[model samples]
Target: MVLKLRSDFFHSVLLDEEKCKGCTHCIRRCPVEAIRVKGGKAKIDEELCIDCGECIRTCPNHAKYAQTDSMDDTLQRFKYSIALPAPAFYPQFQPNISVGKLLDGLLKLGFHEVFEVARGAEILAEEIKKYLSLKNIPKPVISSACPAVVRLIEEKFPSLTGTLLPLDTPLGIAARIARMRAMEKGYRSEDIGVFFVTPCPAKVTEVRQSSDDVGRIDGAISISQVYSRIMNMLDELEEQKSLQFSSWKGIGWARSGGEQESLNEGEYVAVDGIHDVMSVFEKIEMGELSGILYCEAQACVGGCIGGVLAVQNPFLSKVNVQQLVKRYPEYHLLDDREGKELVREGVFRRRRPFQARDVLKLDTDYRKALEKYQVIEHILENLPGLDCGACGSPTCRALAEDVVREKAQEIDCPFLLREKMLELSREIFDLASKVPQTMNEERGKQTIESNQDSGTATGESGS
Candidate 1:
């Protein structure tokens, strides 16, 4: 697919120039170089930006923010838009709200249908089980649900591409199933738009990317934007009715360890944060960590509720989600035979043979890398190992990589250049000291021998 930014995908996170201090914190923190300082203010390069929201987390000025869709826009998609609430959505509305009451509030907003992405999560859970049963899968199969993480693999860690589970994310799968159910009910596809009440920009990007042919999920609306509308409606519907739907176990897939815990066994590893996930994935690929049946990876540190665009704090959301899950029926209680069958047929399969870059090319393609390697070796031979980013790169190795990448010259790195200068200065001083004293002593001996020869010649002439 020719990738382009979807206009409907709301970038709730934004760079506020007036507020930005241009610290370049966002620039360094961005897994992609999405944020760059231009004209003394940080700006997002929309083409390059995957909307990971790392900048949103790093900015002390709170300059980066997400753009919110007005309730008016959500309503415009249809005569009545259905709210596809993610399981993470439940925790945002507190003491006054129950998941059932929240569904009623969505109906109050004129949503003709309300489906939980968690129901899709149950289907996904079944699909994941079947995938695990397959032969010769990548070690610690990485979850591709998080768009920010996928984008990181695409850009920074292409080697991990094979490891990403290509299955359509639960939201996408659920949106498709939701739309199909709507069609079966004699609703036109256009008339029944599925809007995701999202907690993060990553989901927005996923909706825009639209990896599967399911062709559901029209747009993603940030939870922060719709919270007030949903909150007000909850107050209005005093005796709100809950929709008869799938078990809460399915909806319980909202948090970090949810997927791994749902599976409950196997050599599973659940990790959050893009950096940490990559580190673990590397070990898995290198065979340092093995025999992993599943890998639950979430981009936001604490998972979706910890998302940069989330209105509620993540720690509190975890507590709320746990309480909500306790009220949920156990997974074994659900009768999702069709979902399990579909998974066995490989209907919801993830694509494979994903890209791994040629890092070896950096050495083979240019002689300069070898030269830089030598310079790095020499620098290490002399300088202290304390890696300070005062040289502009994050570490000494990064400085060396920068030199090879032509991103920075060797002299730009102060520590390496300082060591070279010091070594050169010492050699020059030692050579200067050794040369003069030996030459002066030899000249003095020659002068004495000449005087002795002149005195002998004069005495012989007088005799």
Candidate 2:
């Protein structure tokens, strides 16, 4: 496939060049190989990067960070701002606090209204279960909730593209519902902006997808940034509503198995963490996991709770999810009628298929690419073969590929430069040895004798 770079996409994950030490930490840790150190600083390839925040987690210098909308500034643009907090947002507060209190906290923090993304998760469950029952799709239908996972599939596992579920994610559904409710309140669509309180930069990238006319939310605020601010405000808030707005199944979305729990039928396989998702995706691609009906892959280890930007311990946050589910183990009336009407009205429209990225392709031309591949292979043969990050590439072969692309040179490899220096030193010694030993030993004495003879001849001429 000839993959095109998504120049239109906005990446919240940015590099502060002044702070980067160029330690090769991000390049080594990035799952998609999307990061490269160029000119003594780390740079992200927007097309290849999934915004998983791996670089943010790995950078010791704090050079890699996420840029999100300032909530204070975001509120000024709209008369009514709805805060759509992700399920991951729940665990950041004190565990004893009620879900209603959390929503109240949002209201206290300046939002006119607040909506649980979990409510959207519950609504999405019905649609996915329906799709699985009727469609003759490939097995192991992957979840699209995590934008990082969806982008990863598009870039690294194109063969499994058909396996991706067609449904929009919980946040997408929540945004739609939030806006609908706002419009019902007499707020103009343009006047009300929906903001997502997100745990990762991936959500920021997803909101930026609005440029393609597919975006649901207006902006995203970093969860870490929102957490401390909200926690400070929680003490002054009072619960103005009740937890009856959402169901226990929706709350389950904070963890790995939560999505499958919302479904009534079909065998389920749920995995979290980017590395684990990659392993499971590879199996699905090989048709090894065909018996499974659904595969929910969360980019973070404990689902959204494990986001790199999160301040809370992921395990502790997961405990909070379980506690919330145990305490609120009740479902709101199906509102089956509303869900059906939504389905009829295309409220939960499918997402556009992600275009596969040709990250592995070296060149656009067939013959030229073939020639470059061969050259890359030849360069690889001369490398040390250790996948060391010293030269800034992840592997020897990667460096060779970069060299072939003229992005780097063999001299960039310290080991290769050392070898060249040793060879030159040997050559110099070998050339010096060509001087006869007698001539070499008498060279200093001969020089002194010539000088003395010149002086004696000058004295005789003067006499």
Candidate 3:
């Protein structure tokens, strides 16, 4: 199998240079240290970025944003388009807005059909339970549902890649099922476009740069883009379609710990937020979390509801989801036979193996990398050890790494620059105070002549 590099992937989170103030806000907030302020502008390192949108959330100037597909452009591209709305999309609205009405609103938005990603989540839940039962598989399987979390593992915790559940995400599975259903209705595959109405930039990036299959999803549109249109259409509609198929368990996947709740059994631990996920991963690496069956990790704080592109308050959305959950049944539309058949066909399985990103490596050659590591340590020793972002890098250690990589100079640190300035001033003062040897000899001779004249004058006065 050919392993792909980080450069091969497409990142949806981007920096708007015009809006960026180079205030180091993004650099400080970025979980992976992917952002840096350079030349009075913020720059994202594509290799290091996981498209988690932490920078987007933290940027006070709104300089960071997700680049998603336009609904108009995507609809115009194909003869028929299907909207695959995520589970989190439902909670963005009021509780009075039924799931059926939300589906109807998407149809009014020019989508020929609307597929529920929650249904796909339900399918995945069943399959995951079956996978967990197998004795051959490893314990503590990690959920591959969140693209940002998966990418984080790829970039930061490569050893845990094997622990990731080798399954397609709910959105990916929904796209596949939606496209298949469209084809069954006599629509040509080329004429059909399946788009995910995503709440996060990571999903947009996943849709654009899917390693498993490029054709699974045509595009991803952010929730913020079509939120107003949906709200306006919701009130105008008189009749709602019976489009809701996902169960309460499926709908619960929008919030934190929802994936584990869907299983309803197992030693599962769900962790939300990228930093917290990292902490869990660290514990797993240290063998501190043994005997666990599965780990549900989400990059966003409140799962998908807290996505940077989401318009609703995450806490309010969580409450809305809970209300919606109470109204729906526990079981989803898919029966056990159909779910088993889909699993047998490998619809939920990942086609490509998760590849580790080599962004952490200092150099390609071992010897050179070791030398660079030593140099970075030496440079780090002179640094103030402050993680302040004033130096553009996220931490002093990062600045040292940058210096070793030749991307930055040691004087980039303000403290180091001040010390250098003071040393230069002292050197200049010493040079300026020294007189030339010839000038010193001439002054001495003049002083001696003056002394002799004064003595002769005193002797004449006495005579």
Q: What's the lDDT of the predicted structure labeled candidate 1?
A: 0.69
Candidate number with greatest TM-score: 3
What's the TM-score of every candidate structure?
Answer: 0.75, 0.90, 0.92
Question: Which residue segments of model 3 deviate by more than 4 Å?
Answer: 1-7, 211-215, 238-241, 437-463
User: Which residue ranges in model 1 land beyond 4 Å of their true spot?
Assistant: 1-14, 32-38, 43-50, 211-214, 238-248, 330-337, 340-347, 350-463
> Residue 175 of candidate 2: its Cα lDDT?
82
lDDT of 2: 0.82
**Counting only residues 3 or more apart in sequence or on different chains, how many pairs clash (N, Cα, C under 3 Å) in candidate 1?**
9
Select the stronger candidate by TM-score from 1 and 3: 3
lDDT of each: 0.69, 0.82, 0.86
Poorest lDDT segment (10 consecutive residues) of candidate 1:
454-463
- Specify the poorest-scoring 10-residue window by lDDT in model 2: 454-463
Best by lDDT: 3
Clashes in model 2: which pairs?
none
lDDT digits (tens) for residues 190-224 of candidate 3: 88889999999999988876533424688899998
